[model samples]
Target: MKKLAITCALLSGMVVSQVWADAASDLKSRLDKVSSFHASFTQKVTDGSGNAVQDGQGDLWVKRPNLFNWHMTQPDESVLVSDGKTLWFYNPFVEQATATWLKDATSNTPFMLIARNQSSDWQQYNIKQNGDDFVLTPKSGQRQPQAVHDQRRSGRHYPSVQRRRAG
Candidate 1:
């Protein structure tokens, strides 16, 4: 009986892995077809206790192979620009702009995933569909510090910028 139970568990694990692989492939194919995208967004962030910490609005622009810009207009003004090779972060209130090599910026970030076209990078996250949304969890075995709910719009596999509430 114990042997049978172990075999059943292994089979179930394989099934789940296959399902995730299919979802990831579909998402990759859809993302590859998008050459440019623009969207306006409103974001609300809460603390661990679920208290509202910040609310803001922004606009996002992405021109693939790898150009991205995010302009935040409310709460505080800030801009993030990536030109395929480098990432620049600027805050008007602070009068400072910091620049870093895109390769060094880490692939774990959502914006990086959108800006990067490599399939290997996308594979770093385990993606699962949840009702009308998708949940992405890192494959590194570390628990995600926060939850990100991705709601697909206009029948696209990837969530629109408006639905990406967490950065």
Candidate 2:
């Protein structure tokens, strides 16, 4: 009876591990297809109580290997660009541009995981499919949850290309 229990436990463990591996693989496969992505976004900032504090619209462009450009056209005129090495935030209204290391800018943002496209990083998130959305929760318990909803009609949707993060 002891041996039977042990064998069953081992088999169950393998099944669970395989399921996780498959989930990760599926997510990675989707992300790998995203070489460049462009989108127009309307963003609303809300407080903890769900009161709208600010609203804005912008155009976003991202290319693989760490290159992104964000242009805000509503509520203000500003631009955030990353050329893989440095991140530049420019505000025409203030007539100022601030530059920071890309690594530093990406540290706390989802862009880090998406632009890096590292499988190791994928392991740090628990990924599951909810209808048409893929939800990602940080395994480290230090970050907010993010969901990826791809509007693409063809091919698998990945993390970086057309991801909508909802916390």
Candidate 3:
């Protein structure tokens, strides 16, 4: 009984610390001056059946007010670009590109508000620092259920950004 009580107390303490470690608010404050940023990282895509269909590394660039360029160079090759107004999906094998409105299109899209510091309605996210990078997950209070459903169908995935090694 005593061992069980101690284990329960330890688990509770860990949970509280995890919640307190989220750094979402701090990141939001720094975003004002962040005109453009870039990074290179690996992405693992899992389907609804929990199967890994794709895994690769890529370079990502983002400019304020919703502009992003993602170029995948390994495993498979593809390019996704968003120029604030239109989003483009370019396939090298098909030699074709499809364009759509940034707001209307959805998928396991990396550029969703999951990348932003706010919710779909522009409310700030619940942030947590997971090791070297920060994870920004939405709060239920601000996230609309309908939007969440729509995003799920589109396969929206937002893992925290991983830091790059210094050269």
Candidate 4:
């Protein structure tokens, strides 16, 4: 009886771990194939006080090797578009447009991380499919890397790799 119970426990653990690994690998596969893709999504940004401050719908465009453009059209007119080297943010409410180097920006922000196709294993974070959505939980303070490449092959700027589907 004792041996049977131990074997059952070990098997259960393997099942759970396999499930998690499969989910991660699936997500990675999606990222690996994303050369230029578009997705529409709604995001609810909450504050530290636990109040929902803003909600909006946006479309994402990613053209690899490393170019991404994101525009939020609902709830307000705001935009964040990155040309693989520089990121631009235009907020109509503030009547301001700010630009910064991609290397200095926050790469770990949820939307940016996903749009840029940053996929790491559960050792750095956990990824699970919640229904049709993939819920990614970052482990502690691990920051996602920003893959910023140059436009041309000059060696000074890392050229963004745009993965094209084979004909």
Candidate of highest TM-score: 1
Instruction: List, residue by residue over 2-96, the lDDT tens digit for candidate 4.
Output: 99999999999998778777866765555555556665656555553445566678776777645777788999878988887888999989999
RMSD of each: 3.6, 4.3, 10.6, 11.1
- Give lDDT tens digits, candidate 3, residues 1-167: 99999999999998876664434444444453455667676765555344555677988787666788889888878898988779899989889999998777743232454334344433434455544355444454332111111111133322334221111
lDDT of 2 by residue, 46-132 (tens): 553555667788887888878989898989989999998999999999899999998777654455555667656676777776545
Model 2 TM: 0.70
Candidate 2: residue pairs that collide: none
- Minimum summed lDDT over a 10-residue window in model 3 is located at 144-153
Q: What ordering of candidates by TM-score runs from best to worst?
A: 1, 2, 4, 3
Show model 4 residue runs off by greater than 4 Å.
Answer: 1-7, 44-54, 110-113, 118-123, 141-167
Name every residue pair that clashes in candidate 1.
Answer: none
- In terms of TM-score, how similar is model 4 to the real structure? 0.63
Candidate 3: lDDT of 95? 97
**Model 2: CA > 4 A from native:** 1-20, 44-55, 74-76, 154-167
**For model 2, the run of ten residues with the poorest summed lDDT:** 158-167
Comparing 1 and 2 by TM-score, which wins? 1
TM per candidate comes to 0.79, 0.70, 0.55, 0.63
Clash count of each predicted structure: 0, 0, 5, 8
Ranking of all predicted structures according to lDDT, beginning with the best and ending with the worst: 2, 1, 4, 3
Q: List the residue pairs that clash in candidate 3.
A: 22-127, 22-128, 107-154, 107-155, 108-155
